[model samples]
Target: MNNTYLTTEELAGRIKYDARTIRQCLKDSVLLEGKHYIRPFGGRKILYIWEIIEEDMLSSAQSNLTIPMANGAVWHG
Candidate 1:
């Protein structure tokens, strides 16, 4: 499926993260430029592919271990 490209601010709003963080962290480490995001041709605007970013975010979440059912106890996975 082809998803519409979104601006940095738009992407930030969808992911609930600051645009600065997206640019600094996910842009290169996870969301690669050109593949996941890119600068508009001959323009200063940046566009992010929603599906790619969202999928990457979900994948990252799955890889990280988060403690569930906290009752004054910590569980390390």
Candidate 2:
């Protein structure tokens, strides 16, 4: 239970994205609710799981390093 919980603004600072963009664009599209964030105690406030999102970001960055090949294959770079 040592996960780093972050407010929207705090997360925006760490990830260099606008808090507004995160709320409007990425909230449900990219960042999922239960997995990446949560509304504690059925309240309105949101808290993000920093470690999970960081890992996903790193993995997504690594995924982009691959070269797309023929027949739906990808050459990992």
Candidate 3:
């Protein structure tokens, strides 16, 4: 894919967030592990896919889209 892999610090810089916040807050919530990023060589170090994150960010910015919940799914209000 010739895509560029970015470290936590690099991603934080691009998003203007602290690396710790990305790991603690965004990881597994907004930015999923396998889908949006991966650990290097199965090591502890995580590398985020810039292209995927960019695409996701753009998609999230679209206000017209809504995730449809399945029947019996938890919903408040």
Candidate 4:
């Protein structure tokens, strides 16, 4: 599959989030490594997979009552 890779700044612009927030807050919390982003060539440069991020963002929005529970489970009301 062809994936759209984006830098933090580019993703911030597309998602309307501050680049600093993306790097500091969302980088390893909401946006996980390997799934939402990657360090190319084992270096420090991070590239975000836009397709996966977008998909999760939309899906999370749709499930209003779905809460993240302990032990990696989700609670749906």
Q: Top TM-score: which candidate number?
A: 2
Sort order, TM-score high to low: 2, 4, 3, 1
In order, what lDDT does every prediction score? 0.82, 0.96, 0.86, 0.94
Q: Candidate order by lDDT, highest to lowest?
A: 2, 4, 3, 1
TM-score of each: 0.67, 0.85, 0.76, 0.82
Question: Which of candidates 2 and 3 is the stronger one according to TM-score?
Answer: 2
Q: Write the residue-wise lDDT of candidate 4 on 1-77 in tens digits.
A: 99999999999999999999998899889999989999999999999999999999988888777888889998886
- lDDT tens per residue, model 3, 1-77: 86679999999999899999998999999899888899978899989999999987877777445555697564433
Candidate 1 lDDT over 1-77, as tens digits, reads 88889988898899899999988887778788878987878587778888887787788777786676658775555
Model 3 vs. true fold: TM: 0.76
Those runs of model 2 whose alpha carbons end farther than 4 Å from true positions after fitting are 67-74
> What is the alpha-carbon lDDT of model 4 when measured against the actual structure?
0.94
Best prediction by lDDT: 2
| lDDT head-to-head 2 vs 4, winner | 2
Residue 10 error, candidate 4, Å: 0.2
Q: Which stretches of candidate 4 lie over 4 Å from their true place?
A: 65-77
